[model samples]
Target: MSGARGAWWARIPEPVLDAVVVVVAVVDVLINLDDTSGPAWAMATLACAALIVRRRFPLPVFLLTLPASLMLDIVFAPFAALFTLSERSRDRRLLVTCALLFAVASATPWPLDDLSSHERAWTLVYFFYTLATAAAPVLLGQLVQARRDLARRLVEIEEAREHERLLHSQAVLARERAQLAREMHDVVSHQVSLIAVQAGALQVAAKDPDFREGARTIRSLSVDTLDELRHMVTLLRASGGRSTELTPQPTLADLHKLVTTSGIDAELTGELPPDVSSTAQRTIYRTVQEALTNVRKHAPGATATAHLWHDGDAFGVTVTNTPPARPSLPLPGSRQGLIGLKERAELLDGTFASGPTGDGGYEVRLRIPNRAG
Candidate 1:
């Protein structure tokens, strides 16, 4: 019971176990001694006393006290020593040596005389008994060691799975944060565009040429500010694909314009649904624009491709790019553009996805319902 490991309650304290060994040795010495041989009993008792440290220095205690067995046959100390040695290292050499010593000593005819020398049959019988006695501790030690190994491996696997779960949780949190950024833009960006359009109207209405020029300047500044805000929102969203394509430089229906104007080498194909709402069209436009921007930032000279089409209940935009044409700029990217695109599509009850292609390139795709309603 004391030998079972991996749980605290199964153990016996070392000092108590040592005390038990000492008491047993004393009793053994008392029982085996002849009534006239007080001095010999005292000497044998001293040798067996070494069992008190049998678990600590098992081999040393076993070897030093083995002679005590020659006088009265002390079994506990040697058995405990053998068990401890096998438990610690599973060393074959030490186990075999201890077993051989026990076998030889157990078979030896004591108080040497000619009658004892002739008892070969008795010697063989005692040898087998001692060998089996030596084997019991070894088998038990191996069992305990095996159990301990299994427990350790199970603990490691659990920890590894816990680490993976934490990583997955962090990834989800990042996506939610990106979605929040896109929502913020949705709330504020439209007002800014309205202000820019009003400034342009003011420029056209002014009669004095100098006053008209001032209004024109104001309008220009407002437009520029709106563009910058959109850029910032796109970067924060990580879903922003191409900022350039998204900003309505061309009509939303023209997918070819998005691929051509983004400055990345790329191709465009497919037709848009004629009845698509302006809202759905804008979402697809921003998606393609963000994809192109991502290609420019991450892939540099890589060729890009765009496919715009209508999928039954939804309008789809797919943008893909070849691997980078040149070494990347050392600058880090915000990835807001991609996130913003994803947020835009989802808000319209659509889907968005992006990943690497098999040939080391990248792809981004978005789908939105044909009508904002």
Candidate 2:
């Protein structure tokens, strides 16, 4: 209940709070104006007015209230100023000095007159009493300041915890993706590869024309399916964004073998520089692999040509395929292969383009700077 009230009190506007403080100080000064002189009245008025700017100039405002404290038996003006000073000032020495000055000003007689030794002792006793009393506001102000600091620190610690939780969630998701990729590669891919190999053997051994043709179709579709599965597995394994490899990455050296096993009539021509980086070689291999797979699925009975060449400051591969001699079989596809290839090329500071040729053929091209990895 007290916390709620404090929060509501904090919501009050600064100017309104300042005005209320000034009015309270003025009332305190008026109550003690019974036998005070003109100078006392003037000092009291100045002190009340000075409260209006106490927050902006705490030390100076506290000094202005000292004269009224010395003459009039008023407590609000000086205490208010002292509290403001203590709340704002971080220097312990300055606060101690201010508190001592307030104590001396309040305890001393207005006129400097000769006093007996006993009277001087009594005055010394009054000064210590007032000094102890002045400590209340100072301690309260310091407590408030420490509370504000602790609140800010708590907010920062909460934000740090929230960020740590988000990172932990991402780490869990990456591990799950890695597990899924392993299942697809080890179980699903192996079974599909066996089916493709069996279909190829049957196509060669079968004597009936229709049976051989059906077996060839099965082998071609199986190969295409396996290619897509490999791309998906690669993406899932790399989802963690780490450099560690879970499988042997293909490079330009494997290009000939890829073409031979593609289940399509494809020819690889030309060659890249032998000094090409491993990353760039892998990119080239994937590009050619995806293009030939597209040809097999979208352009049945089409012959494809993959040509690698270097020109000026760039080097890349271009895969072009003749138009399909027969209608393509309907195949399931997520259609993200080309998008993935385009993204991969962009990562290497390269470009990818694919469209139909003027002769109704399809062409896909990838280009990367010679200096790119």
Candidate 3:
């Protein structure tokens, strides 16, 4: 509650605060106005009024208040001015000098009459007392200044920490993108290479003219796809340092194009609900892609079907391929594609399974909760 009141007080206008200070100083002077001469009253009034501009000209206001301190018993005007000066000034020597001047002014006798030895000694003692009293405002002002400095420094430190967190997050994202590029080059490039080889062989062996033409088209598409993949890999690898255009991310809507250009006899069936998130759509698309690529690589001359289905609380895709009619190629395999797909499924709180079916065919399945959206 005190903190809230302090904040409310801080919101008060500066001019109004200065006016309040002046009024308080005048009241203090009036309270101590017993037996004061005309000149003393005039100086006290001057001191109180000078406080109106003490924030802008603290040293001048403090000097104006010294005469009043010397002639009258009032303290509020001079101490207020001294505190203002101390808070704003960084020069320690100047603050010490002003403090000493205030002590001398307030302790010395107003009239320039000769003082007796005892009176002079007592005046010296009073000077020390006044000097000690002056230190309170100066020290309080310095304390407030230090508190403000510490608050500002803490704000700057927090901003630096926030910026560091942002950089760290970006670095982590860049590393993930680089890793993704490596996976695409390793897995997708290998599948497209197999498609090119198969098309070339089919083109040479086929007797029908239309078969030869289709093989040529397939081979041409495979080469073009390899080129695009190479470009995409280059962009993804360089994304850490500079901006680069990336290929559009695949979604359910692009499943038809993916199945058509997959360089295999694959059929896509069924549809997911329209409310699925982009992340889920991309995950589903990648699942089918990897499943189809595996069938072309490991099950030659086989027909594959991708079925998308959703139950009350879950959705998924299953890709099933018949047994190969021809012997599989002796293609190298690292099995990283399936591992990546499994990891992707787990990240979305889903499951992935792939194994040979009872009919000597292979089936890959992915199932995710609807909340994965």
Note each model's CA RMSD in angstroms: 19.9, 22.4, 26.7
* CA-lDDT, candidates in order: 0.70, 0.86, 0.85
- Taking all chains together, the TM-score of candidate 1 against the true structure is 0.48
Stretches off by above 4 angstroms in model 1 are: 1-11, 35-43, 115-118, 172-373
Of 2 and 3, which scores higher on TM-score? 2
Model 2 earns a TM-score of 0.61
True-vs-predicted CA distance for residue 214, candidate 2, Å: 3.1
Candidate 2, 51-98: lDDT as tens digits: 999999999999999999999778899999999998887788999998
- In model 1, what is the error at residue 234, expressed in angstroms? 8.9
Worst 10 residues of 1 by lDDT: 240-249
Error of 3 at 167 (Å): 1.4
lDDT of 2 at 262: 75
lDDT for position 221 in model 2:
96
Model 1 / residue 182 / CA error / Å: 7.7
The TM-score values for the models, in the order shown, are 0.48, 0.61, 0.60
- Could you tell me how far off, in angstroms, the CA of residue 18 lies in candidate 3 after the best superposition? 0.8
